[model samples]
Target: MIANEIKKRVLIALLIILPILMAPVDLFLAPNYWVKSLVKCILFIGLPLILNNHYQWVSIKSMLTVTKKQLSLIALVMIATYGTIIFGYQLLERWFDFSMITVQLESSMAITKNNFWFVFFYIPLVNALVEEWFFRGFGFLTLKKFFSRRWSYFLSAIIFSLYHVAIMAHWFSPLLFTLLVIGLIGVGLFFNYINEKTGTFLTSYMVHAGANFAINTIGLYLFGMI
Candidate 1:
């Protein structure tokens, strides 16, 4: 119970801090970019240490179980998801006469200058693994303890969507926000389902990594950002 309470408190604190850390651009360059980075360091780095030390978070081995079929399935799912999104975009464009959807993320200073190695390696491998471990692993499980399964799923999806939007609120349009939120819900469910079925964070990590990698890569190339 105490652990549950601590988990809830941590999540609530994250909820409170993330928005302020990611306020809309105070101009073109966002005056609060440094503050946002500081908050991210605290949440993504510092909070994990505290949780692992104080709450006995799951072991690394337990978090990432490797299996042949699991990895292949993850790739398949990612491909299928990307195809579906492309199809949806086409349909929406045809029906609604919309051109394309685009959002600009604040890339690292080093990455903007064609640092493909840093963007590809750091993003897909390290960042994806760490994010899925924290959000879908610890955050999802902790939320499930206090809420119904449906609510837990919904809440996690909201958090995922909100995190993305909060980071780029300056560029967020209503149409893109809707699409992004819907996409995030699907991604959240996919991760949660993988975690539940495989009973390992590794499986979810693979799926999460695949989805993020596909979308980011495709989006960048298609939108001429790469």
Candidate 2:
């Protein structure tokens, strides 16, 4: 009973508090971008691996592989997600001005724009892999121990969405931030859904990386920094 209570408390903090704390730490405490990203990766990915393993909160598995059918579906979804983002951005550009939007993120994205190859390569690969492993694989599964499967999924989504608060609130207008909250929460839920449905972490990672690729590639180019 004592052990179970400890596990529940730990998982609750991870799922509820860690994500909220991430923004402030990155925004105020971290000394530089390098440290900020490293800190985030360690907290989001490393801490879970260490604690969850120690607690035996989940079973270890080969989360990197997908069957042929799953692979095909992932490919189709990747293409569709990338295409949709591109199309949607084009439509937005036709009507609204994004100069204000781009400027808000200029400092945050300057490094990305300068390191085009890094953004093109790392963001979609290693970064996505770690995030999926942390959130869907560890965090969501841990919550399943204390909650129903659907509740686990939703809570994971909430944590993921809240994790971006510092960025969204600081780098976006109120209206844009509100919209982003809704969108990213939906995305978080969707990724968890895909992970559960396909029974592999790679599928959800692909969808996430694909979406980032779509947004970042065009945005960097437009900023004239890439």
Candidate 3:
């Protein structure tokens, strides 16, 4: 079973790695959106499908049946947490003399336009669905079986941060590393808390996806980062 989980993780890594490899070639071709679309399908859709096969799909369905109270709590927590992160980042930027992170406002701006349905669809599908399924769903559950809950959360967050480091390998900045770690830690804790509090991973999954959507849209509007 352990070996099987390891194999599953390896598969997830491959899905992530494929996009990284394809990115440059796609950029060269000028039809970069197609490459990203395919990558999102493999990483988000493929990974979740593999995970669902390993676990009973019924559990996921059950988890999604959240109460109104739980939904309200999640919304409150997400807002407070999001606010704290924004304030903290702004403070850190001033304290450390670091530049404010640039948001890719282009995506959100384009998304608001009537012509960008494709980008809008991909945002939810690839970023929220695929990424959350692999990292917060599969990765989080797998670690919990091996370690204490807190440890599992931390480890999973660390791995998530590291996995994302692949994209920033060329930049090599300590501040970026710190931000990535902080971001992943926030995501891990928030998601894990939702799972534990609600007794279902899908509760966390919905929050994760919702938070991602909000952040991407808001970030694009405020900071221009996605």
> Which candidate leads in TM-score?
2
TM-score between candidate 1 and the true structure: 0.70
Q: Where's the lowest-lDDT run of ten residues in candidate 2?
A: 104-113
Model 3 misplaced stretches (Cα beyond 4 Å):
1-34, 54-58, 93-126, 142-151, 169-172, 205-226
lDDT of 1 by residue, 58-133 (tens): 4545556767887787778767765775566556554452323332433412224244435645666666676676
Query: Where is model 2 more than 4 Å wrong at Cα?
Result: 101-106, 109-112
Q: Please count the clashing residue pairs in each candidate, in the order shown.
A: 0, 0, 5
TM-scores, each model vs. reference: 0.70, 0.88, 0.62
**Top lDDT: which candidate number?**
2
RMSD of 3: 5.5
Judge candidate 3 at residue 182 and give its lDDT. Answer: 77
Q: Tell me the whole-model lDDT of each prediction, alpha carbons only.
A: 0.60, 0.75, 0.56
Distance from true location, Cα of 218 in model 2, Å? 1.9
Q: State model 3's lDDT.
A: 0.56
Cα RMSDs of all predictions?
4.4, 2.3, 5.5
Which residue pairs collide, candidate 2?
none
lDDT (C-alpha) at residue 179 in model 3: 68
Q: What is the lDDT of residue 164 in candidate 3?
A: 51
Model 1: lDDT of residue 21: 51
